[model samples]
Target: MSVHETIEQALVAPSYLAGGGDPGWVTVPLHRACDWSYGHDPLMPRVILTSPDQQATLRIDPDPDEPWWTVRHARCGDRPAWSATFDARTPVEIIAALTDALTAPTPPAPGLEPYDLLRQAGWHTVGEGLISPGRIAAIEHYGGEDGPWFADARLDQDEGGLIWRAYLSNTTPPHLIAAFAQALADPTPVRRPVGRVPAPAREHTLTRTVHLPVGDVAFALEQRVAALSARRKDATSNTHPPRSPRVPPPRRTR
Candidate 1:
């Protein structure tokens, strides 16, 4: 079978049990763990997810020249609109954190200190950004107090190359950034295919494949379709009331 088939049968997993850093780590939960409406096309290697309330959206595209993941929210009440972006190659676990936080049932508490959040997650100061315990990933702040936030995984090769990077405007909610910090500090290894994983993750010992039945995604999609159908049926019924039974002219006795 093809490499895609092999990946579908059994997912590359880290012994630690957390999701592997593959793009699926972020994609699966957005559908399985949240109530986002999902859309995709086989002709395209991307997925678009919209919030149930229609106030927010998430997109995943693996094109190397463009952002891989992007989240945008519409202004609601007192909450200001915002956006977050992740470049291709960004660790899947990192992006997953932001999604989990974004879709949380309850809004994240306000007034969180970014520094404290990172500290709580066990990330130590390394100048502008904090480094992961494994020292493979790093999240930095640049452009002074008003600059955007960044996250990247890098390797010190012959010339030192970056594995991936992510950006978040300073206006991004603090809660989302906090979630990112926690994920960055997590010691668990993310799952990844033997040949397709980023160079940084591959430097570590790999674990056995884990069964992530593809049925789960299908089931989630089924639920979404059922919900949409029910809503549409209700709408149609309400708009066009049933017609009264037709009555024949007084018996054709004539």
Candidate 2:
């Protein structure tokens, strides 16, 4: 199909996790905000972003056939290391929240605790996990000398198992973890059409049909693209100014 035709078709059923939205919502913003080195495979259309320190990596692969590993993040740290993966259907909005949290320059907000944040957000303990108010989602947390603490989201479960999940590693800045806590805690209903989402998801996630405007998401995405573009423009202009003779620092001699 022609590109124009494809765009029209997507407009009719533009729903979160329905496979029509662009992953750039998460990738582009994070790239510009964190200044991660970016690489792409034009043919397969995959995006791989590596942190400047090379301690973290984010990969977004949208191919539905490869659902086992769609959006993945990994960080290598001192004592413990961790990796997070989400299925192909996971919403970019949710992932963006975690990445957005990482953009903050300050240390983790005062008095921010992941478990307490979850509890305040209406989740309660169930043995080793914390179940959401809707009971469709749960969290598995672990910590000790062997491993650092982490709160993982397992959402939209039924007989089919974990529908989609988000793993934010403990090493992944504490403030970012708090960002995720706020994201998952948000009561805002994700704008997804009933038929477009998974059957199991609808069973537990069904709620009042609140027709919400998704323009904010679209606007935010456009803003990210513009911001990234402007920053790159400034960088390019600065790097290649008219002409300035290069001078090396005097050689050090012992």
Candidate 3:
């Protein structure tokens, strides 16, 4: 079968359980996990699969110049945490790796200071335990309609060194939320070296302009005219009442 057919079948196939009765083994939609594009070139196909926790991602995309497919596994947005290359013929091996990644345990969340944790949670920290204008705006936006219930957090410095206060959103998973809560309560300061701010995410816009032959263009225009005429006729009919039957027919019958 063709590569496309193979991938489609794999997607639709039953979830591959790593071990017997493992509940974590769940089927993930290809679009949600990967950055696969419908318009990607067939010669250099790409596929990515992310773990359920959003910690790990597996990518399979061959470089245009390279003959082998570059299969990479990353954790916490770290690209190529682990990687390997395979010949074009070995798609099965690549699929196996992706399946393995699905069941793999996510690496522990990085140790973060109280101030840094707030920043990671979509808050902007201006000074020590202080909020930024952007963070205030975010809080307001989150409390508005179509926003999560747990919108903002309150931080203060009391007799205790630092006080972090936040309510858990109903939407937040219990286990993950508890982890965050525990991390915030911990007294130990962050030991890891602070990493530089990551660059903003790249945005892509696709524009396609189709050039049609004269014959096709003319046909399209004719169709549009017909559609408009039908619409106008319907509108005119709706605006006016139906005409009554003539009384001459009744007189002739009499």
Highest TM-score against the true fold, candidate: 1
The C-alpha stretches of model 3 lying farther than 4 A from their native spots are 1-45, 52-54, 62-64, 75-80, 91-94, 101-254
Model 1 per-residue lDDT tens digits across residues 1-254? 33243233223333222223456566555665455788768899788988789988889877767887888888888977888887765666677678767766555667546666656766677887776555656678777677778876555433246666678877777788778766665556554444555434544434555644455533544554455445546656877899999988886655
Per-candidate local distance difference test: 0.64, 0.56, 0.32
User: What value does the lDDT take at residue 68 in candidate 1?
Assistant: 78
Tens-digit lDDT string for candidate 3 (1-254): 33222111001001110011111111122332222223345665565555444544445554544423333335344332443333332223123333333332342454554334445544464422334332321122244333332222212233231111223233332233334333323333211111211111001111122333445433433553354445546656877879987666554553
The residue-level lDDT of candidate 1 at 146 comes to 73
lDDT of 1: 0.64
Model 1 CA lDDT for position 36: 72
Report the Cα lDDT for residue 210, model 2: 41
- Candidate 3: residue pairs that collide: none
lDDT of 2 by residue, 74-95 (tens): 4344534555566666666656
Clashing pairs in 1: 20-190, 20-191, 21-191
Ranking by lDDT: 1, 2, 3
